[model samples]
Target: MRIPGVPPAELAELNRAQDRLSFVYLERCVIHRDANAITATDEKGVVHIPAATLGVLMLGPGTSVTQQAMMLLADNGATAVWVGEQGVRYYAHGRTLARSSRLIVAQAAAVSHRDRRLDVARAMYRMRFPDEADTRALTMQQLRGREGARVRRCYREHAERTGIGWQNRTYDPEDFDSGDPVNQALSAAHACLYGIVHAVIVALGASPALGFVHTGNERSFVYDIADLYKAEVTIPVAFDVAASGSTDIGSDTRRAVRDRAHDGAILHRCVRDIRALLLQPGAAGPIDEAWLDEDAGDDTLRLWDDDGAELASGRNYAGEVDF
Candidate 1:
């Protein structure tokens, strides 16, 4: 007998991108399916999680997930990410929620055009420095320099408020422990932020590798998106956690970031910000019209036409092609 995959109606009932949790981290547990929910069984006990409500599932070291559990996660449009031992480093990610290619197409067009790309980059800087009036005359480099100064000031202020050491941001990528207490906390905090940002990016069907300001890395777009919230969310949280002088700074930082994400509705804000950056202004079409309201990841595939337009898929165009 064929197993019933997630029915289209059930998939529609799953939580929207903005309404879900930012992410959930699981480690050293056996993740298996239990009806509609997934269970994580450890030495202590089994905990049941409603898989449909889960946004991103981070599987860390020593975790064993069953096949049925994976099926449920995919069926629910929930992204599963394989993470490092501490749950900070990302190894890989699972399926995306989006089935339409509209957001990515818009993203590519924006990146390909120099003026549009610069405008989007400047808008990103504006998101970071909302109070900075009159940035229209500033170049990208100048904006970046100003942003750096602003971030530095944010760090110093947080340090003073939390009584944490105010030092330069320094970290050895190869060695997490090599950084100062605050730096280590910052790294851990940033990792959580990256995970949430990445989940939103993929869920929206946008390319994470294509970035406006950040470059090269596969997670360049993830970094660019996460930077919008660093000063307001991660930086202050990192410093506060560092000031507590917890032995398990990484774990503490993750929890704090998660709490902040919940309080700030980070996922919702992320969806809005990404849509604003990528979606074209005054774009016309069924797909564009559908997205203008909010993010709706319906599985509507279209065929690309040579004349820079899209046509409905699944049509027999042999006669038209011959002509």
Candidate 2:
């Protein structure tokens, strides 16, 4: 895929360093490709979103996006996610950054190996509670208990500081309308955090279905990564937004979470954390084209002709055909 203005070298650099891009969230807008830019139009006016420089685009309720805009996003390595109100629910996701899938292989290996998987899980717990003395000795059950207690304390502290009534989190997906404003706000904030974490996980080519701290479901890994940042980012933001008594609690919470994410450089932190957790120290460096070609055998590889049709023989560019 040829990106129009950017040269090949610069484009490669941009694709490799997507961790530096900022994240944008859009709701109730129409997104379309305008020349080389992705333009979003709302009742107010049209605004150009720098898709290439975006890590994630959260498309919330009432968002309509054109195919061309999606293609542009895919070409530029930006992830687009369809979400519910204030990003409280994830509906779907677009194409991920087409880089090497070595990270995915490594992640799968780590998660599938019983001993290493436990180590990775412990690493995740240690990251969440850095002050914990001995994460290595704690079983998954003990870790869960500690995490639950820590989260409860975070809720209590935030509620006290923001003067919002502290209540157990209660939300009915079937009837979000009937849920408490505080619960709704908390859900919204956590959703944004999850979206961001999910995008980073996908960009790194890691399987979201595989998780260490969290297990089961499609977004288990996403939940695990988002938990690392919840107390610092979403928890407080939720409380503050709810305390403000805003009529649009969900929108207010999402906006505050976005601001906090930007201020905290959460995407960069997520990237660093994922690398640290998944990749062992002194592991082989980033996978290269040669490594990928060697790993993908001839039977699994497909050779394409110039007209976008697959050739009969499974051959690569070297012209040394494999039958």
lDDT values for all models: 0.85, 0.77
- On lDDT, the leading prediction is 1
Top TM-score hit = 1
lDDT of 1 at 268: 92
Error of 1 at 89 (Å): 1.6
TM-score of each: 0.92, 0.83
* Candidate 2 lDDT, 1-323, residue by residue in tens: 76675332233445443354545778888999986678989999999976667788888888899988987887777888888876778888876663555667678888888778888888777878889777787788998899899999988998889888877988887666677888988888888888888888887678887987677889999998999999999888888888888999877887898889888988877877777677663222332334333123233334557887856654345655565
Instruction: RMSD for all candidates, in order, please.
Output: 3.3, 6.6
Question: Per-residue lDDT tens digits of candidate 1, residues 175-203?
Answer: 88988889999998998899899988987
C-alpha positional error of residue 295 in candidate 1 after TM-score superposition, expressed in Å: 5.7
TM-score between candidate 2 and the true structure? 0.83
